[model samples]
Target: MELNTSLDVVPVVSIALMGILLFVLGANVTRHRAIRGATGNQMPTDPTDRMFIAQRAHGNAAEYVPTLIVLIVVCALLSDGWWVQALAVVAAASRYVHALGMLTSKTLAAHGPLRDLGAMGTYASGIALGVTAIAAFA
Candidate 1:
């Protein structure tokens, strides 16, 4: 495990934060749903409020696993060089950006192609890391 360096965990932990955020918020919102909730015949305490939490959990691992794997692979297999570090940073930053973009999607001003841009950033960052890994260590 020549490449099992601490740097590999940074991006992974960052991604884990995103998943945790989504899970905590999403499960909270879901539990609040009145359907088959607490009482079978009574309305929720707040009937007018619907907690709309953004589903940034990637819904499942299949969604975010690709990005996570790319980052981990690059960090572990690629040499500890500037390119690897930069790519990992991009991936980390993009995850936060994407989550931010999603949280603001309901706003009239934020509902547009820009929301997709954050995801694009993540994809582009992963692609860059893959390419760098191939170019530098393959």
Candidate 2:
């Protein structure tokens, strides 16, 4: 009954975190798309413009989801411990910040580092899972 992270459901921590991000970001994208389609306004004019922040958020969500799933699955498969779980949480949180930064008209999305963070999250997690899986059973 005590909390253990080694081989028993450590992935749940990140699963819950990712789940929250998926739903929240998915809803935001849907809203942005609907607004654009209905109004044809194109929201933000540039990275530093109004409504541009949300658009950037929408973009980040679209970019990182698939790889995140792969990473999560790999970690779950390996029964990854706290580090993997922590990475998953960080990935989710980073994505959220990237998206929210998009909504502020201040260009906190950076058009550079934030995107790189997301890519690293996807690639690192995926690579960790892939390498471990191959090394274990191949």
Candidate 3:
């Protein structure tokens, strides 16, 4: 199978957006930590704490974004199908939604609709991208 030499705009945009989101989340965590200087607890254990929430939001994005970006890039490289592009967009959107949910949430332990929807979208898009990549070989 021949690979598409041209750049895939959708996947590229999606990847860039995800990268930006991850960076913002990480910056938020750092900002919170810096605000709570040496005298304050550097590592907050409470889920309700703002610093803890920021840390979790950044950590969660870090965990999922890299894998999703890889899957999106692989799918785009393997195939130039619209489905791949759609999945990439959905994956990126889900990550944003998840981050918003986490940031807006009062506590991490409680279930939030945005978080649930984002998680479901993430799973669905990721699975679809993986399947599409595998099918491209056929």
lDDT of each: 0.55, 0.58, 0.90
In model 2, which residue pairs have backbone atoms overlapping below 3 Å? 53-102, 53-103, 54-102, 54-103
Query: Which one wins by lDDT: 1 or 2?
Result: 2
Please provide, for model 1 over 1-138, each residue's C-alpha lDDT reduced to its tens digit, 9 standing for 90 to 100: 255445556556655665565565556456545444765533323323333323232332236545655555665565666566566656656666665565555542234464576578677877777676666654
- Candidate 1 lDDT at 29 equals 51
Candidate 1 weakest ten by summed lDDT = 53-62
* Candidate 2 per-residue lDDT over residues 1-138, each given as its tens digit: 222234435455556666677677657656766766876666556766444555556555666655665666665556445566665666666665555445543555355555555556555665665664455344
Q: After superposition, how far is residue 135 of candidate 3 from its true place, in Å?
A: 1.0
Model 2, position 62: C-alpha lDDT score: 64
In Å, residue 116's CA in model 2 sits off its true spot by: 6.6
Question: Once superposed on the true structure, which residue ranges of model 1 sit more than 4 Å away at CA?
Answer: 1-53, 60-62, 107-114
In model 1, what is the error at residue 57, expressed in angstroms?
Answer: 5.8
Q: How far is candidate 3 from the true structure (C-alpha RMSD, Å)?
A: 0.9
lDDT of 1 at 106: 58
Predicted structure 1: lDDT: 0.55
Best by lDDT: 3
